[model samples]
Target: RRSVRHAYCQLCDEAFRSQDTLRMHLKGEHQDRYCDTCDQARLLPSSLFGSDYALKEHHVQSPRHAYCQYCDRHFRTHEVLRQHYREHYVQSPAHAYCQRCNMHFPSGAALFDHYRTMHY
Candidate 1:
């Protein structure tokens, strides 16, 4: 095979060294996902992913999605998340909010946990 500059995966757009490596990646990483066709596909199978919820968590937490799983809401932009947190924390007396992270929690304990794991 001739040397090439880069080989891109149609599935996830991840670049590889060669076509063989890309084929290997597709057969391994792409095959493990719940979807068979496309890496961008969001169809999840409970039977296969019953033990692992990483993808599900990623869908909610990933900034690219502009979604807030805690509030069960979707925003137009990721910046809306900060606005939502500010409004929610200010309106709800029982809720806890972190200004630095622009995130809200149901309770102070949850916020503390976030601080310990993420910040401290």
Candidate 2:
């Protein structure tokens, strides 16, 4: 027989086959952090994801958000995402540049790769 893995929710005394389901359950009665507006939203049992803050962080970084909590903004384009570091955003001191857009890379290899993939 194959063993099954279960994630137990302490809030409702229920066990789930997937931790994702348990996380989904957090948006139920006890906590409202989960976005019901999201297409993935579904009804599931509740509780035990450590804390509401963790859930908030997870939601903020999820596909629905596409946000940078550090910058406190949502990036509409990949070019903006690549220039996330505020200092290197549109030319401050970073040497990397691809025609109007300024981006910062940790190494020369990354910069070259970006140029080849995006500019060339």
Best by TM-score: 1
Q: Please give, for residues 1-120, the per-residue lDDT of candidate 2 as tens digits.
A: 965759766656677788777777755643543444342332343432346555556557577555543333556654665667444433443544444246766544565577668754
Residue clash pairs of candidate 2: none
Each model's lDDT comes to 0.58, 0.53
The sequence of per-residue lDDT tens digits that candidate 1 reaches over residues 17-107 is 8866776776677654533222343333643433335555555655566655444465667788667756664456366766557787876
* Deviation of model 1 at 65, angstroms: 1.7
Which runs of model 2 end up more than 4 angstroms from their true locations? Answer: 1-5, 33-120
TM-scores for all candidates: the values are 0.34, 0.27
lDDT of 2 at 30: 39
Q: Which ten residues in a row have the lowest lDDT in candidate 2?
A: 39-48
Candidate 2 overall lDDT versus native: 0.53
Reference-based TM-score, model 2: 0.27
